[model samples]
Target: MWWGHPLVAVLTVWTRSAWGFSNGRVGVACGDMGPQHGPRPRPDPPPYSLSVDKPSFSPGEPVTVSLQALNGSFFRGFLIEARDSEDLQSPAVGVFSLSAPQQSQLLQCRSAVSHRTGSRKTHIQAVWRSDRNPPHSVQFLVTVVQDYQVYWVRITGPLVVLRGATESPSTAPPASPSSPAVLSAPFSSEGCGLTKSCLREPEGCRPDSDHRCVFLSFTADASGRSVMFELSGPAEGYVSFALSLDKWMGNDDVFLCVKDGGGVSIRAGYVSGRTQPELHPQESLWGGAWRLENGLIQCRFHRNSVLPPSFSFNHSLFVFLACGGAHGGSVLKHQEQPVVSGRQTVISGPPEDLRGSRPPLLIRLHGVLMLTAWMWTASCGVLAARHCKHLWSSRSRPGHTLWFQLHRTLMVLALVLTAVGFTLPFLYRRGWISCQRRDCDHEAQAGCRTGFLLAGSMQDSYSERDTHLTGPHIYGLPARQHTHLELPLKFQDTTLPDEMLVKIQITFLVKLLENSSFVMPPLLCVCPVSFSSVRVCVGLRSDGDVTHTHRLHSE
Candidate 1:
């Protein structure tokens, strides 16, 4: 039906509209909803973008990367993911989120990444769902380039920094006639790259005249902590260096200190500097070169109550040239020369024994002199007594000529004997006593031929006998045999009557004899008798019989 007039011919025929038409389905009348429209769609948002302030960094540096969303309407929020080139598939890749209207987020790239040399890339992506067919992804690439900067300085061979003079390898060359010498390298107390000359040459280093003349000057913060100073160039021999504390402290403090290759201290100070009164011309200022392996010169300042602040002072080293050529020719020549004087005597015995033996000869001489003086006094007394008796008897005869002659002659003879005896000991005391070589002579007395006993007993005895004449041991005495002796003694009584005295004495004798058979012998024959505790007693009877008693008591 033709419905030209809107709504006028609608009742005439019912026809299906294109919108309602279905294949193989009954047609239905179309109702006109003219120009119908659903809710309008919003415009699609633009993709997100990422930017990094810096992607390349040196070791120990930090970099920051930021993510930005270009269009806000893409999604309610976006998830940002960052992955390193080697960790792209790792679930632990750095991920973060930014809500709509949020434009950027920051990620810190650590300096540890610099460990990997060469170029590396980090992929930064943002994912968001939009009204489009599927989720959209936007990515940016960050390239991390590793750049490493290192600085170091080394002294070659034996060349060291010169003190007082500014010329050095690290010192800048003089510009012209106007400029003073300056260090080529910057001076620093800490951190890397600070360098100075070595006081001694390193092993295998060539020893040119100029190189040997120079030495290293190292200054520390006065903490005395060991520091490493590198030496480069040709290595050779034991490098000997000296530390001059004179400038920092005083000349007295200047010591040649050396540490061995094994890091132990080998020697210090002047080797021949002794605290004696005499000065030797051979002794020079104590210093010289040591082996090269001992190139490291460590100087320790003595800690004291008046020490300066740790940062106040510094350590300095100096190089002492070899005496002559680099081959140690000077040392060899010095060793070949013979020693002429000032040789020290070596005393080897134990100190105490040496001291003890020094006085015996003197003491023996004095003892002999004392004996002679006593003998002289005794002879003079006898002569004086004899002269007095002669004077008393010859009062009428005026004087006895024979008596006077005899007295004078006797004194002269005594003096001669005394002088000889006194002088005899001096020979032995003065170390002059020596035995004479003897020929075999059977006609000589056997004892005389055997030589006289030079050492005799010097002790005194009550019997006026020489102790040397007694043998050290003797046998055949009672004490040496049965170690017993019987003594009988009787005491007469005058105060009491004979009858009473006899009765009392008998009673006492009976009591004493009761235990006589069991008593120990008074004369002890014990091989080792203790004289300290030996006691003996004798009981006497009126008839003059004696009983011996013995007792041993401890004090």
Candidate 2:
């Protein structure tokens, strides 16, 4: 009875309308395995394979596209474009070109799709070209879905890892369906610490001193799918959770708006560089569900959205917790921390991976050796300057001065050290970079070294890209000094809690010396220092700048 004329025609019309299929094409009805249907014809296989590194992505995030030659022939180059639709009239979000390839290659691209465009689809098409063969093209599709998981990553600087606990990826909370992951970390801001009392200072987070010291703890549900963060402090007014993905200051930024017991549903939005995050309800895919209980501000977000946009999983992510106005007028106070530094705050990974996380040991040794040589040379220069009169004195000499012989001997030693140190880093890198099993797996190791060389090659380009910054930044150039001679620490090869911070200070000192009126060669004037032993002597010039300074230290 149901297989009659009117019923069959009605069902056919409904099916065609639902699936948007043309009447001329044969279509298979649901649950109809009849003989007339035969078997659905298989479409032709693709000429090549296209894939991306991540499971999914958010707008503005960079993605790595991998192209593999499937047939007998390999592609030489490619012209790739990303579009929202197949319509010929639809404009592409961006276009890129790949240089000559070696069978397979991974390329990077930044998605320009707007988050406000609800459930829009993206299509990426690559047309491969070669000199001796015909051009081949391939297409791939990506779906945009709502991100329900929120990742609550913790960032601690080198200063916090005072204890010698190995902070590797293997230590990460294992997946468990039964229990929530509880993390309790204590961060103290003393009476006059950076964020509270010095709020108006250049390095401070905000200009308000009303901020009080605070401690925070978090509980993430199984599998890191959900998180509940509780903040305990004098955090009155608006609370803000800012996620920094790209650079420390400006890049792809996501912000969460905090209010009452359950203020408007948790909200988050993205901003590039210094622009304010575009926070609007209609366009955001982040659910932003949060609540405040027992004087603690509790917030949750899609965890997967917190991961880096590209291939870097261990990238150091900066999360800033601050107090601002309810409407996001300006921040009052905040604490910023680095979650994963390849050296100090290690977020568990395989042992080999952890080793690879560090720049090759030889390279670090090379840095120390070169620094030692440069520091020795500069120390000799300063000593010679300070005791020139004593060196040429008709009578014997002063007790402190090594009578210039010590300085000359140091100069010779520095020269020798410089040569050896300069040659050490290159010893392992044959004519080109070589991969070693002790360091990492072949692919990742190769990629790391390649990325380093590439970044070094494009340092100027990178700096230029960062110069046009847009956000609220307080850092500024140092005040001009009339005369300055900076003495850096000597023998800096050691594992200590505050060593990196000291090195940073020394670097700043070196930079100031370079900018001073006394033009000493900056690169050759490096020094290192050892903790627990040191001596410093300063000589001032007529222009009120320290013309000569010496720091003696022993480990």
Candidate 3:
């Protein structure tokens, strides 16, 4: 049974008396529909199986169908019919007869599937009938995938669709107008490409008259759940694709690969939370499949693994493409993140539509304030150290000590500046920290210990002074053996606020059996000058005898 259109093909299997003609019908076997004049004889079943090379076929691609018929002696004549899944009428049909009934034979046919404007799934059915058996049919389904497509976005230019580049090439040459491009080193954040809407390029992608470019063409196999990327650039180097989960540098999840002209490829992955993306040393990530042919590097990876496990197809992803040109012949020069000298492109896919959005306003303000306060504190401290000497000078330098008046003024000015600078951060968060130290060991046998005051709270906790620092560590005492200094301190108040009222007491224990004179180092104190005032007191005791007392203040 032949259809008038050349595109229609039907396979028909018939016997001498049984002419099976089944068309445009459903759930009806071909043998039952044969021209029936009277009751016919039933034949033995044919020993054969029908199979196709591949389960699916794209439009215009040919499918190879084979039927292996064994013990041909059981059948003196036979016929087979192949029909389209949608329109069963007018199928391309073929028939054959066994001259010598003792041999086995194979039946094969090749046909092309017509291209449809839209993607569709359909099947082709093959039915066989013989002298000894009823009509037997088998069906196979195939999906006709549409051709590949590409959208190009130039750095410093508008996003444009390159219509002619849909034909995927095996390899890329140095220059091709139709090639999808990466477009220069140190790729800026200004431009990228996607399969969907084409958005305008940002200001950062504006070209500065000198830029290099790269091109990429890709196709997806939906049945296999994989995508193939074909890359061509100036270098015979390597290529990589990165999925930035947060659209930020130093945090991209990337897949890197290298392929030689011989079609051998090696790959690596920088996944999980790897800040510095590098190929995994122990595992090869090219489990899917890849090749380099005709100067074009082709790579395929599973769609499910393109992003981190934390992200799904529904979540937006920042996609990046990069190429490492060959330096000479032995070593490949690849670009690091922020690709200074290399070219790159950033494309966004799914969910969020925009790339490279600015940070929130409050975050910017907090950074500026903290930086300014730190700078002010450092400058004031340096100036005070260079000019003020009254704070550290002793009575031995009587003549030079006359400069105390000028020194005190500079010292006070520095304190006021430092206090203001140091208080800004605390003011922003209403928190500050203070420390007090005491050495209670009278014979200098115990090691040094430290304490702390928790910021922004009245409660305090102290750790046991277990660590030893007694290796003759005489920090502010006269240089002599068997001579020691003991200091004890207590804090009466613990609250810290804009105006913290702090009450502190100190005791000094000095043992001087060989030396008569004792000296006390100047104590430094600072408080938030914006609230009120600050004061410091020092008492000197020698050989178990009270000697001198001094009080310092600045309001």
Compare the candidates by lDDT and give the number of the best one.
Answer: 2
* Alpha carbon deviation, residue 354, candidate 3 (Å): 5.6
Better of 1 and 3 by TM-score: 3
Q: Please, what are the lDDT tens digits per residue for candidate 3 over residues 304-340?
A: 2222122223334555555664432222434333222
Alpha-carbon lDDT, every model: 0.26, 0.34, 0.31
**Residues 2-120 of candidate 2: C-alpha lDDT, one tens digit per residue:** 66989989998876454221221212210111112212211123344556554333333334554444445342222233432212113334333333232212233321111221221
Give the TM-score of each candidate. 0.14, 0.27, 0.26
- Put down candidate 1 lDDT per residue, 1-555, tens digits, no spaces: 555686655643343232121111111111110111121111111243345444332222322444343334122211233322221222212323333122333233210011111222223332221121211111223221111111110101111111233332211122231111222332222222133222232322332332432222332323232222222111222222222222111111212222233321222232212121111111111112222321322222221111111111223222222211123211111111111111111111111100001123434564565455436643553455344444643422434444343444444454454555555544433433233223222222221211121112111221111111123321222222123333222222222332343344334433333322111122221212232333344443323244556443443
Which RMSD values do the candidates have, in order? 42.1, 25.7, 25.2
Among all windows of ten consecutive residues in candidate 3, which has the lowest summed lDDT?
A: 150-159
Runs with alpha carbons beyond 4 Å of true place in candidate 2: 1-250, 258-266, 280-384, 391-555
Give the C-alpha miss distance for residue 92 in model 3, angstroms: 32
After TM-score superposition, the amount by which residue 144's alpha carbon in candidate 2 deviates from its true location, in angstroms, is 8.7
Off by over 4 Å in 1: 1-194, 197-214, 217-266, 270-555
